[model samples]
Target: MKDNASLLRRKDAATPRGVGVMAPFFVSRAENAELWDVEGRRFIDFAGGIAVLNTGHRHPKVVAAVKAQLDAFTHSAYQVVPYEGYVALAERLNRLTPGAFPKKTTFFSTGAEAIENAVKIARAATGRSGVIAFSGAFHGRTMMGMALTGKVVPYKTGFGPFPPEVYHVPFPTALHGVSVEDTLKALQLLFKADIEPKRVAAILIEPVQGEGGFYVAPPELMRALRRLCDEHGILLIADEIQTGFARTGKWFAMDHHEVAPDLMTTAKSLAGGFPLSAVTGRAEVMDAPAPGGLGGTYAGNPMSIAAAHAVLDVIEEEGLVQRANQLGERMRGRLEALKTRVPQMAEVRGLGAMLAVEFCAPGGHTPDPDFTRAVQARALERGLMLLTCGVYANVLRFLFPLTIPEPVFAEGLSLLESALTG
Candidate 1:
């Protein structure tokens, strides 16, 4: 059998350095919330493949659906032949996503593709070129995605000459000392100086910032953006790529707010580990783009569509939405209790199962990325996997599968506490 060390040597030579990997070991197989490396070392998964396995790795239903699809047909180029599963999944999303108005849905291969196409649809519908995003928000890594992303270091560093007509404003975060009023004022100034509201095609935001540190977008901010979009004829786009599929205790993060977005990008856990994404929007807005203008060769792969259908079925039948809330509350309580012992724990915040804990210098507000890295390292040493986020790399976010067994979840949490306290 090929050992992990040998595989690592091979990987170093075969893969480019641009694709950064977290875990040192090579995954041999995974199931639900656990995985085994090439050496057969078992570890509890807390990252959930960066929020791509909300239903867990190789969910039985998802696997069964894909296997069934494989027997029928595999790739027919959705744009050419098209299939019923694609349309069925789209129909499910239209009804499932938040919004009382008539909606339409289209598929894509990745979250970034959904964002790019949403931009096109918004521009076509509004006849505008300007798009407004917020700081500490993560859209994707594509050219247009990079332009809209708020972070600069890794995502936007070497990749320059990004798409133009994209502007950014501060996102409200009490920990960062930015307030809603401050964000609103910055938008006004942006309109007065950089781009007018009339020229804006859309204002894109993550209902819960993913790569930007899992900060939940304030409800007041959502309400203000809705009003501003209404006054300016700009479409509101919600990037729910990482927060979709009951991860945030809801089907979509936007569902937690009273107002609904004009267009929403959903992926990651949407297809239960399958490479599938979608953009759902108001019917008229979605119809703006000419039929031939949208879609890709593998936009809605039959296998992915079939898996998505099973994913939706599992979510409904198993009540993962409610499970998320239950798990989040339990985890939050444990973390809160531990905060008394660990002075570096700055904050514990998130909605439902989509929670994160920020670390800071002892008794100080300064971020402590060193300590965060230490905790992650310690967890990995003890057979647990964790992921870090935040602009400062000082936040540890939890993305455990909602369907994790109680005994396994408890074991993972115990390991996590030891790592944090040690």
Candidate 2:
């Protein structure tokens, strides 16, 4: 309706241009795997708010909990006044996240804050200043987070002179011709050329590279990092912001590996649709930050805690982890078959529901971002939403809500097939 168009126009006028938004479709409502625009035209939510709605939009349990919390009270920063929901959420994270060591969790308002605090704690605990990030990683928009992020365009452009002692190394990706050995070599080089390992506070990595592409960190690679960290006293930090909850068929994407990181960062899906990020880690490391060192005005705000507690409960009771696996297998199989039809289709890979279909030229050697753009345009016209990624911008990541029905998923796949052929 004209109302949707008008709202979008108003949004453009009011919001900062730095925030890049696509297709100004105003959402009237979103439920499960679909979103209805203000005009009531329904579109499948394959983007799922960029993997934030792992349990799907407004899941009954999550909604009920938020409403219940509203009836009582909203804000009371945990520091000022303790809340049961905050403690409950932390307890859940401590129990669910990987690692047998005693763990503690602290909440924040966004993934970036969680990451920043995680790094702070790591440095405070180890008394070091160096951190190693990876190529193609997207940490966040904040200065320190951007310094840690590898992507240079939109994210890091014009905002140079980032935090000191931050270095970038290669991340393993077979399709991109990057190997685990290459990654390890880059890390070794980083130590020798950039900073000594003993002086490095932490090495932060996404279990599955999120904004870069859905490149899963190899189990061998993670184990090697664990070994290296143990040898050098560097804390291993796993950023599960986009792959936590049921998105990866596990509580945390790091759970896929046998090795456990010293610290894990999570957000996005943590508080259902609300904002809540956290840093969960070994008790000793987490306690590195002195009593008042790790928090914000909104950190562990009462309302976010209520939502997070409900999210954990919903994930546990619904068997969403298994559901994510089934969804991944089904979607990835279809994508694999499409490789034959589209010789440009490079690779189909992922773990659980977090999957991606990358495209390259006919030789399957060079990324085809142009073709990827065309595919996305066609799909959007057909009422199917999609998001792209990759350092080369040639990846089409599919993050359909794990709770989507079988028929809806199949229908989206059919439409996607049509888009590719067109």
Candidate 3:
């Protein structure tokens, strides 16, 4: 078997530098919340494959579902032959997602596709082209996704001139001094100075900014956006790509809000580890797209659809939504108690298991990405895998599996404490 070093050298030689890898080691195999490297060393997974493993790796239900799907047929492009699993999954999402009106859903192969399609549907439905997004929001890597994404260093560095007519406003962050009123004011200014409200097709937002940092969108901000959308005939799109499934202690983050979105994008943990994304929205809006206007060749692959069905079964049967709250409460309690000793731990925020701790310089608000990196390094040294996010790269977000075992979860937290205070 090739060791990690040898495989890494091969990888570097074969793959482009743009595809970043976090861990030094390469995995040989993974189970629920744990993995062994090519060198046969074990590590506890807290990153959850960047929030793609809410039900954990190789979950029996998901695995079995995929196996069964394999024994059946693999693909005859969804748009070609079509499949019942795709329609069934769509039906489930339509019923599960927060909305009372008649809804329709379309599947895609990735979150970026879902986002791009959502924008297309909105434009077709509203007969408008301008769209609005927020700062610190991460949509995806495609042209439109990159256009809508707020951060620029890595995602949008050399990738312009991107799709035009995409506008951005500051998202509210109380810790960073940007308020809800400030964001609303920026939107108003954008409509006045940039694009008028009548030309805007949609206002896209992440209920909780994902790659930007795990800053939960304030309820006030959500309500205000809904009102603005309603007044202007703009469709409100909630990008629940990272915060979907049971990560936020809710089926969807929008479930926590009083108002519902006109359309929603979901991916990441939607099909356990499989590559599947979906755009679910109002039936009328979805129908705006002419026949054959949407869908991809691999959009709603049978294997991924089956896995998604099993994932839903696991979440319901295992009670992962409530489990998320339980895990988040315990993790928050631990971080809150450790704050006294770890002065650099500036803020502990997130909803349910979708939590993050932002680090800052001692006794000050300046971001300390160095300290954040140090904590992550120490955690990895102790076999606990972690991931960092935020525009400043100063926040450590936790995406642990909701199905993690008690003993393993406790051990991971213990290792995390040592990493923070050590």
Candidate 4:
């Protein structure tokens, strides 16, 4: 096999530059919280495949379920020949997600598809077309998803002619100078300026903005948005694609708030490491779309569905929700201690294990992307992987698996501290 550099050269020659890559090495194998590169170099995995491996890679239960399903069949195409696993997984999600009222769920192949379908369901249910998203929000990479996303740099740069009737308002963040009241007022102004309240079908938000930095939505802000959606008859869609499935110390991030969304879109970690996404919502709203209008050819592949069921089981059996909280507390404590030594460490924030540390210039609020890059590069050189996010790319977010062994987690932290202090 070629070395890391040679393989990277081959990758650059074959893959498009638009698909950004954070690491130069190619992974050969991964377990729990560690990965080995093609060249046999070992590293601690802090990125967790961008938060898609909350249960870790190739978990025993998840792999066993996939193997069992593969023996039976691979692609029956749920839409063509409906499968029981698909319905069962949907039922589990309906019961687990943050709502008590009757709900229904439908699966998709990606997060972007689930977002599109949720929007369609909301529009059909309310007979409206407009959608209200927030600044710094990230929905997905698809046309409609990009339309709803707030950032404009990489995701929306040449992607003009996005779907219409989509508008963005400020997402409240203390670091960004936006307040909850300011955002709510902006929503009202958007109704008066761009689209009417009644014409808006839904307001989509990430309970915790994922790529925009791990900014947790204020409880008051969630309550206000719920109220606004109720008054305007607009559906509330929680884009929990990043914060779902025990990443935030709960089954769903919305559980952190007392409010409930009418519709929710989830993916990423839904099927452990498999490609599966789901849109779960109120039964009546979900049924708004005609039966045939929804669903895809590979909507809920049996393997992915089986994997999801096992992933849920693993989460429960391993007490991952509680484990996430414990891991988050330990990491946050370490970051906080490092903050005392590194003045550039502007903030350490997130819910449960879904945490991040932001960097800024000393004695100023300016985002220090350069410093963030240095930390990431240093950590990688020390055999630890890290991911940088935020609009300015100055925040280093941590998504290590909850199943990571204590010694491995401690070693990653020590490497992180060295990177930060060195």
TM per candidate comes to 0.99, 0.98, 0.99, 0.99
**Candidate 3 weakest lDDT stretch, 10 residues:** 78-87
Estimate the overall C-alpha local distance difference test score of candidate 4.
0.93
Q: What is the lDDT of candidate 2?
A: 0.89
List candidate 4 stretches off by more than 4 Å. Answer: none
lDDT rank, highest first? 3, 1, 4, 2
Best-performing candidate as measured by lDDT? 3
Please, what are the lDDT tens digits per residue for candidate 3 over residues 1-422? 77988998999999999998899899999999999998899999999999999999999999999999999999999878988999999999999999999999999999999999999999999999999999998999999999999999789999899999999999898888999999999999998899999999999999999999899999999999999999999999999999999899999999999999999999999999999999999999999999999988899999999999999999999999999999999999999999999999999999999999999998989999999999999999999999999999999999999999999999999999999998
Candidate 4, 1-422: lDDT as tens digits: 76999998999999999999989899999999999999999999999999999999889999999999999999977777888889888889989998889999999999999999999999999999999998888999999999998888889999898999999999998976889989989988888888889899999999999999999999999999898888879899999999999999988999999999999999988898899999999999999998799989888889899999999999999999999999999999989988778999888999999999889998878999999999999999999999999999999999998899999999999999999998
Which residue pairs does candidate 3 place in steric collision? Answer: none
lDDT of 2 by residue, 1-422 (tens): 35777897898889998899866688888888888888888888789898888878999888898889999998877788888888878988999999998999999999999899989999999999999999999888999999999888779889889889998889998886899999999898887887988899999999999889889999999999999999999999999999999898887898899999999999999988899999999999899888899888899877778888888887888888999999899888888888778988888888998999888899857889999999999998898999999988999998887778788888898888888888
For residue 293, model 2's alpha carbon misses the true position, in angstroms, by 0.5
Against the reference, the lDDT scores of all candidates come to: 0.94, 0.89, 0.96, 0.93
The superposed Cα distance between candidate 4 and the true structure at residue 152, in angstroms, equals 1.4
The alpha-carbon lDDT assigned to residue 110 of candidate 1 equals 98
lDDT over C-alpha atoms for residue 115 of model 4: 96
Q: For candidate 3, give the lDDT of residue 174.
A: 86
